[model samples]
Every structure is written in structure tokens, then in C-alpha cells.
Target: MTADDQRTAADLLDAVGPAFGKLRRTALLEVDNPISAKDLSRTLVLNLVLEHSSHSEVTVGMIAELLGSDPSVASRMVSDTIKAGYLTRAASQQDGRRTILQLSDSGRDLMTRFRKHQRDAYDYITADWSEHDRLELARLLVRYVDSVAALKERSRTKEGDQ
Candidate 1:
């Protein structure tokens, strides 16, 4: 990126920082119980599970891997979700000892509502942008995420080697 582009990017980041902070605060305010002050992270995890996993069984390990979290953390989240009436666990048909998880009806309903809110929020934020701008933003965001993932993998490899 040119110096002008870098400056513009920095300005954009600076402008959006407060917007995200406010959004995070607003989301927490919406929740009845602020469990561990991790509302945003939990919501993201729930979204991942709902989006990637079919109504079919999904393993705790898969969720953990996808979220780049420890298995115990994912297990705890699953347990909490189950307790909250959002998820159900059953014995895996493939492995009797292994548990498989699926979202309860309540979970699906909750996700649908959250997704609608998310879309509306996103749309409002980008309302002024043209379709081409929206598509370019989407493409760039994907590339940025991919690059960050690669950097994370490299860091993990370095840590493992040491």
C-alpha cells in the first residue's frame, strides 16, 4: 500500500475502533447474564457452530479447532450451552464413547434472531457503500483473514519448535 493508503487505513481503523467498542458494550447490555465478560467471544463461537455444523452431529474437537481454542474450553462452552437449553448432546453412533452435539430448537431460534440483527447492523454500517465497494470489502476482508490465519499458524509452528 502507498503512504496515502496506509494513512487512510490507519484512519479507518481509528474511526472504527470506538464503533466496535460501543457495539461490544451494547451487546453485553442486551444479555441478561454477562457470563465471564466473554459475550462477544461466545456469540462468535455459537455463530461458528451454527453456520458450519449441519443439524447433524458435530464433535467438540471440531469446534475447538475451528475456534482455535482448547478442547476443554470448547467442552465447557458446550456444557454451558446445554445447561442454557441451547444445545443437546448424545452418544455418537460412530463411537459410542464419544459424544456428539447438536443445537436444540431454541439454539436455532436464537441463532436466527442474532443473525438477522447482525445483518441489519452490517447493512446499516455499509448503507452508503455501493455494491462494488461492498464486494471489494468482502474480498479484502477474506484475504486479510486468510493472511492472519497463516501468520497464526507460523507463530504456532515457531512455538512448537521451541
Candidate 2:
């Protein structure tokens, strides 16, 4: 990569975590939803359940692994979200004895509004940018997320072997 490209990469690495942390901490997190999440972790649990439920059943154990937290922490977060009416527990189809998590109807609505708030924020932030530049940034952001997911998977596998 060129020196400019190297510098840009470094800058991106430095900015991503703080930017996302701030975004999650923003008012947009509530998104004027009827159900109020206790904190950022509640929202994260909802998002994680939504993201993983398509291909895998979500459970407290899964959330703990994904969040890199103790199972007790994830269990408490899940329990709180459940009490807030954003998540529900059900028996896993594959294992009747195992419990899985699913988003409540209200949780789905919150996510829909959350996505809209996110898009509005992105448009407002990049209002001065050209369409091509905006699209490129969107693409790059998704790519970065995919890269992080891949790294997480690899790390999980390595941990399993030890």
C-alpha cells in the first residue's frame, strides 16, 4: 500500500471503536422506542439476537461468547432485556431442553426505528459528500464489520483448541 493508504488505514483503526462507542451511547440508541433498554448492552443483546437468529439459535451462552463476557453477565443482560419486553425465551428446536432467545414484537419494532435513525445520522453526517464517496464509505464500513466477524470466529476457534 502507498504511504497515504497506510496512514488512512491507521486513522481508520483509531477512529472506529471510539466512533461506534459514541454512537451507541447517543440518544439515537433509544430511537424514541416504546420499550426502553436499560443500557447499551441491552440494545447490543437485541441486535446480536437479530443478527444471529437467521442462521443460529441465540442463547445466553452465545451472547456471552460474542460479547467476550462471562456467561453470568450475558445471562443478566438477557434477563433484563426480557423484563423490559425486548427479548423472549423459547426452547431450542434442535434441543428441546436448551433455551434460545428471540426478539419480542416490540423488540423488532425498536430495531426498525433504530435502523432508520442510523440511516438518518449517516446521511446527515455525510451530507456534503458526493454519492460515490458516500456509497464507498458504506461499502468499506460493511467490509470492516465482516473482517471483524472473521477475526472473532478465528479467535474463537483458536480458543477452543487450547
Candidate 3:
């Protein structure tokens, strides 16, 4: 990489850690407006189910794998989310022995409101930025997250091939 490219990457790496913590704190506090989420794990579990349901079943194993968490920890988080009435676990139809996750109605409602709060927060935070810049940042952020997931998946596939 060029000197400038290397510097840019270094700057990004420096900013990422704090940025993620700030995002979690902001979501927990400000985003609690319409409907408060119990915790970050609750939000994450619901989101994972929502995102993965179209393509595949969501299980505690999937949650643990994707979150890079221990299976027991993922199970506890899922159990807590279920206790809060935001998620439900059921026997998988294709594999009755496997438990799959689905969002409850309350979960769907909370997510809808949660998204609105996120958009509001984004607009408010970026009030000084140009509309084009704000939209570009949103797009780039999603692209970045997808790239990270793709890389992790590639690593997992390589490990499994060994």
C-alpha cells in the first residue's frame, strides 16, 4: 500500500474500537426512546434472527458462531431474550432435535421502533454534515460490516477444510 493508504488504514483501526463502544452506549441510552431494549445481546439476537431467517434457520449455535461467543453464553443470552418475550425457541421442523429462533410480535415491534430511533440518531448526529455525506457514510458502514462478515466466514471455511 502507498504511504497515504497505510496511514488511512492505521487511522481507521484506531477509530474503530472507540466507535463501536460509543455506538453500543448510544443505542442503549438514546435509542431507548420508543421502546427500551433489555440489553445489547437482546437486540443482537433479534437482529440476527431477522437477518438470517430468510436464508437459514437461526439457532443458538449459529448465534454463538456468528457472535464469536461460547455456546453456553449464547444459550443464556437466547434464554434471556426468550424470557423477555422478544424471541421464541422452537423445535426445528427439518431437524426436530435442533432448536431454532424466531422473533415474537413484540420483538418485531421493538425492532421497527428501534430502526426509527437509529435513523433519528444518525440524522441528529450528522446534522452538520451534507446529506450526501451522511448517506454515503451509512452505505459504506453497511458495506464494511458485510465485508467483515465475509472475511470471517472465509476464515471459518478454511479452518473447516483442514
Candidate 4:
């Protein structure tokens, strides 16, 4: 890329950082319970389990990988959530020696409410947007994120090679 292209790309990516921060703040404000970043992280892990995982069980290692966090940090977050009655740890059905996490009833309830708040926020923000525009935005945003993730993986592989 040319220097001008690089600068423009950096500027655009920098703008997204603050936009994401604002979104995070808005989400925290919408939640009824006071929560720390760790709590939010745990909630996100639970959401991933609920939405993405086919087995409905996740290990701390999986959480760490998903969150791009250290195992210790992920473990702490998991422990906190478990203590708060948001998650339960049990032996994996496939392997009794392996442990997995699942959301508790309270966690499910919290996620349901959180999802509604998120949907409401999106509806409000896009009230004037045509349905086609909304769908296109969602599709493009996911594509952008996936592209960034792929780029990051490539960078990591290059670094490892070096």
C-alpha cells in the first residue's frame, strides 16, 4: 500500500476503536446489574456457548482462545461467573476427566434480557434504515471482522516464522 493509503487505513481503524468503546459503554448502561469487565467477558463467553457451541459446553481453554485472553485471566473470569451463579462446571460427558462449563438458569435469563436490550438498541439506531440497508450493514460488518481476524492470524504466523 502507498503511504497515503496506509494512513487512511490507520485512521479508519482508529475511529472504530472509540466507536466500539461507546457501544460497550452503552451495553453496560443497559444492564441492570453493576458489572466489571470480567463479568462482561464472562457474559460474552456464555453468549458464545448459547449461540455458537453445538455441544453447549466450553472449557477454560476454549474461552481463553475465543477471548484472546491468558488462561489465568479466563479462569478467573470463569471462576467469578461460577461464584455468581452464572455458570456451572461439570465433567465432560465425552470424557469424565475433562471439565466443561455451562450457563446456569440465571445466566440464561440474563442473556435473554441482554439479547432483547441489544435488539432494541439496534432497532432504535436503525429505525430510519431500510431493511435491505440493515441487512447489508450486518453482512458487511461480519465480513470486515472476519477479514481482520484472518489478517491477525496471518501476522501471528509470520511472527512465529521469524
Clashing pairs in 4: none
Off by over 4 Å in 4: 1-14, 27-39, 55-57, 128-132, 145-162
lDDT of 4: 0.77
TM-score ranking, best first: 3, 2, 4, 1
Q: Arrange candidates by lDDT, descending.
A: 3, 2, 4, 1
lDDT of 4 by residue, 58-135 (tens): 898988887889999988888888898988888998889999888899998878766676667676777798899888
Q: In model 3, how large is the Cα lDDT of residue 88?
A: 90
Candidate 1 Cα outliers beyond 4 Å, as residue runs: 1-40, 55-57, 142-162
Task: Tell me how many residue pairs clash in candidate 2.
Answer: 0
Total backbone collisions for each predicted model: 0, 0, 0, 0
TM-score: which is higher, 1 or 3? Answer: 3
Per-residue lDDT over 77-114 for candidate 3, one digit per residue giving the tens place of the 0 to 100 score: 99999998989988998899998999999889878877
Of the two candidates 3 and 4, the one with more favorable lDDT, higher being better, is: 3
Candidate 3 at 27: error in angstroms?
5.2
Candidate 3 Cα outliers beyond 4 Å, as residue runs: 1-13, 31-40
TM-score for candidate 4, residues paired by index: 0.67
In candidate 3, where is summed lDDT lowest over 10 consecutive residues? 28-37
Residue-level lDDT tens digits of model 1 in 117-160? 65665566677988898879778867977897799779889999
Indicate the TM-score of model 2. Answer: 0.77
Cα RMSD to the true fold for all candidates? 6.2, 4.3, 4.2, 6.0
- TM-score, candidate 3, is 0.83
TM-score of each: 0.60, 0.77, 0.83, 0.67
lDDT of all predictions:
0.71, 0.82, 0.83, 0.77
